[model samples]
Target: MEESGNAIGFLENKTILITGSTGFLAKILLEKILRIQPNVKKLYLLLRATDETTAMQRFCNEVMGKDLFKVLKKKWGANLDRFISEKVSVVSSDISVSDMGLEDSTLVEEIKHNVQIIINLAATTKFNERYDVALGTNTLGAKHVVNFAKQCPNFKLLVHVSTAYISGEKEGFILETPHKLGESLNGTEGLNIEIEQKIIEQRLKQLKANGASEKDVTIAMKDLGIQRANQHGWPNTYVFTKAMGEMLINDLKHNLPLIIIRPTIVTSTYKEPFSGWIEGMRTIDNFIVGYAKGKLTFIPCDTNSIIDMIPADMVVNTIIATMMMHKLQPPYQTTIYHIGSSTRNPIKPGDLLRFTCQYFIKKPWFNGDGNAIKVKEITTFNNFASFHRYITIRYLIFLKVLELVNKASCNCLEDKYNDLKRKLNWVMRQVQLYRPYLFFNARKPKLSFRVILAKSLDLMTPT
Candidate 1:
């Protein structure tokens, strides 16, 4: 990461186990820690693979090969292999599976002897995941990992990457603490885990008994997640399950040395291994895509609403800082840190939308016409007409025009348009799955907006 120097705290000669190593946050953390400390004993990256070969393939193709590490590559020169072999390692695993999917005895023994610090970044961030599926991944998966953590003889700290929305509905100021299950993040009563789990399991069983295949069951479950969201005022299964998982962990943390980092919305790096080196699908990327296609003319966010976000590198730095601090701090409550720039670097979604729209106008995305799509300024309206118009103008109009071209010239553009429509619909369905959180009329303003705005403006503007 592009920092002034090292840091106030560091993880030197520490063995760490990381879940979700293939995840966005994990990749940054792994890269930064290894680069900064250089002396950290070893890193055990848990992958959702069956064995070493599959895990290694994922590590190379997804992790090491990314453009984000180009700066470090220059520094390490040809000694990268020796560095990776001596310090970094990968272990095939998944939280949803028992024992973190690490069934390999030799690997387990190696971990038992080496890894002492555990960073669990594995999470199903898709807001629309099914309850059963979410529980399997978010709740049960957490339990499995923590159970594994408990078994670690030399374990010192466990930092769980949780969302700030764990606070749920009632919003004013969300303090950092364990939001125990059956207790809401805002102090409102929440669903009991046992009851919620039983209900989901029963529904799944009914679907199975009806001769539903695995795919059929998944579809059924996804629908159930949507229904659950509607009932609970949440948008999807992802947040619901994560909230539940946080509660369970808070309830069960007991005497465990743990910390929960509740990051609001994570965006691209401000300064890292390199500037503007963005990768993967994220909220910012989605906004960019919408801007490219001329589907997002206006943002449906509060002008003063806080789109709390922190850079990936900053969050990683905070993770290492918190871990290092806990190692030096005395035992007490589970440390909960809100790692968001909304306090010191708030950037409105509307402003972001404006900036993106303007950027794309000069360097526009072209189709066959080599002309950008036309769009008018839009307003925030929850009515069906607003959504219907968007679908019609942005998607339907484009497809209809393609079909017209196909008919006039007898071209294969018709099939292409149909495929594009299918892809767009899939994305919309996923968005609708997490509608509650995104569309929730909650604007947390406990953090200062002016300072954050000033900093963001400075970053957006050139040096």
Candidate 2:
């Protein structure tokens, strides 16, 4: 797996189709390609919209409109629009549906004939997503993407972006291995996709028959996802569905050139397109934001536990390099690449906490009252039980007092009580979703041959 040719050279005059164009990593990938390879033939973006016009609007507002594209905008300046218009095409499509929900036959035919690469990045990333939705988007959506790729006669490669957490909450050195169709991590029998779909349909019908409210339905669906995931030995719905998606792709992709990239805890950009650029709260970013705003004061996590993280730019680079390598030397079988820092440059939760404290001490965040919030060392609980006990003693008792006070005041403090209750529920939910990672016992993933080759070529860097 020697890197013989330049990645830039490989992209020249190549037409590529990218799904999830509005997502975080997808935007970074799009930016890198357009900025570095102006000569690339075409970039067809599949967006979820009612029509092409709406899709283009989403592309402008969500994708190019992001700060990630600032560097490219600065470089292209006045010619930016023109360059984009010539090189990029936005199509209205939904991966959750068959044929990616593409109704325009002309556009579909055009893509089938000209597109040489299809990168599937669309996914439902919620830890406790609805079973039906997660199944449709992450699992069945993968099948749809593969079916679409089959129509492209000249398709050189299909890069499926997935999470490394798809390995679930297993303890040990996780490997870059492909999942087999209908396989369950716990060795549970009868893990059929068709059966799962049927179960979802049956549950929905029952809910409808019982006149379940929307809220009830949502809660039931989320609970079902968690139940099914746990039954199959996964910790959450997102990873469970994603793992199924990989299985489907691996099984369906008979002769197609495919690469599955599992990136772990993707953080802010490290170098390319500028550093420290991040959008929305993602994984650890939530903690960072919560801490900075003086909202997060304590956490239940082992300070010594390794928190695998990789920069957005590095992940993008690995994707590009992997694409290039696959094109140059297509493998006989599908390749899996784990893009993470746990193995090479691991950082502990304590290290991150210390860094956050030091940074905030120097430049404190000012609240709405224009007062600089004083920084303090975060309280860490070694395990969930201790944290639960603390929450019960500290917050629950106070909540009970608030309830009594509200009753005495004749609903005068009702809003405050309700708000506090909601916040506590949110906190509990968040802790449940994040508990697996906080106490994860798995060693770093064993890098695959391709990842090793890419790193050796200096195409990917951990720092």
Candidate 3:
């Protein structure tokens, strides 16, 4: 196969099927493909919906309706809808199910015959997602995708988007390596997928027998996920299941062309489409939001620790370039790419804090009362022990006092005590979920030649 210098040429007249069309990365990928390669044969967006109508509606409202597509809309003007109608097709499918839960045989056959590339971006990103849900959607989900890929005679490549934290809480340089079946980060034994599934089933059955409420069931499941992950030496349920997903795909994808991309802490867009464009509060954004609202006074994090992060647009560009490269020069086996900026352009938590403070000071956040909220420097703790101590002394003690006072006053301050207690619990939970990243010590993920090549070609711009 001859190599082509132009990524646009590789995408020209090529049909691509993308799962998780409603996700942030998927939306950017979709917008980029249509913007750069309008001549592309077709875009098969596989969204989790009841039917094609609902899928199309979601594509319009959730995917294309975002400000990310403003550039394309400007260029296409009145013909944008017509262009999308001709080039895009929304398919209702679920990656967790076999055959992607495709009910329409005709649509399924058309996809199998036409799709040249399949990008598996569907996943449950919640760090503490339920064990059953995470296992089904993340681990077994990759297996189902590979099984479907085997049925596609025209399939050239399958790109599985995964997180770099799937490496777990490690301190040294992480390499671009495949996770062997049953491989555990901390060398735990008997990490069998079948046994794990059985464990989830047993737990659920016991909870159901006890007549657990919906909220209770959710809490139990979340706690079970964390317990299982800890038993297998992983930090959280999301990374543990994702690692298993890679293992399953590698074991089953015999001769299939596969590329696994592990991106670290994906942030807002650096450039392209627009700058500073972000969908929801994610990762460090949570801290920023809390601090801007004068709610966050302290956090558990190592200010000196480097946070490996890459812009959304850069990750999207790397995916496109990787796809083109793999299609042009097919690898002998599955290839892994770690898309992040830790090694090349690293930023410490302290730097991020300073930047946030500087920005908010110039333009302070306004309150509901139309008053500018005062900003203050936040206190950071390097370890959980110190943070816990501070929380107990500062907030928990105050809450205890309030509880005593309310009881003495015959529950007169009940509402205030309840509100304060609820806020404290919420903050503690958020900190616990984000503890891994906040004090992250991972040095950097070693980049592959393909990733270096993409960067060299300016496919991924430095921030």
Candidate 1 yields a Cα-based lDDT of: 0.69
Q: Deviation in angstroms for 360 in model 2?
A: 2.5
For residues 343-401, write the lDDT of model 1, one tens digit per residue: 55677656766676567666778767887665444344454457667778977888888
Winner on TM-score (2 vs 3): 3
RMSD of each: 5.6, 2.7, 2.3
lDDT of 2: 0.87
Q: What is the C-alpha lDDT profile of model 2 across 302-385, one tens digit per residue?
A: 899888898998888888888877754555468888888887789999999999999998999998899998879988999888
Candidate lDDT values, in order: 0.69, 0.87, 0.86
What digit string (tens of lDDT, one per residue) describes model 3 on residues 343-434? 87899999988888888888899999999988878788889999999999999999999999999999999999997887677678789888
Clashes of each: 6, 0, 0
Candidate 2 wrong stretches, greater than 4 Å: 1-4, 328-331, 409-422, 449-463
Query: C-alpha displacement of 430 in model 1, angstroms?
Result: 7.0
Please give the lDDT score at residue 315 for candidate 3. Answer: 83
Per lDDT, the best of the predicted structures is: 2
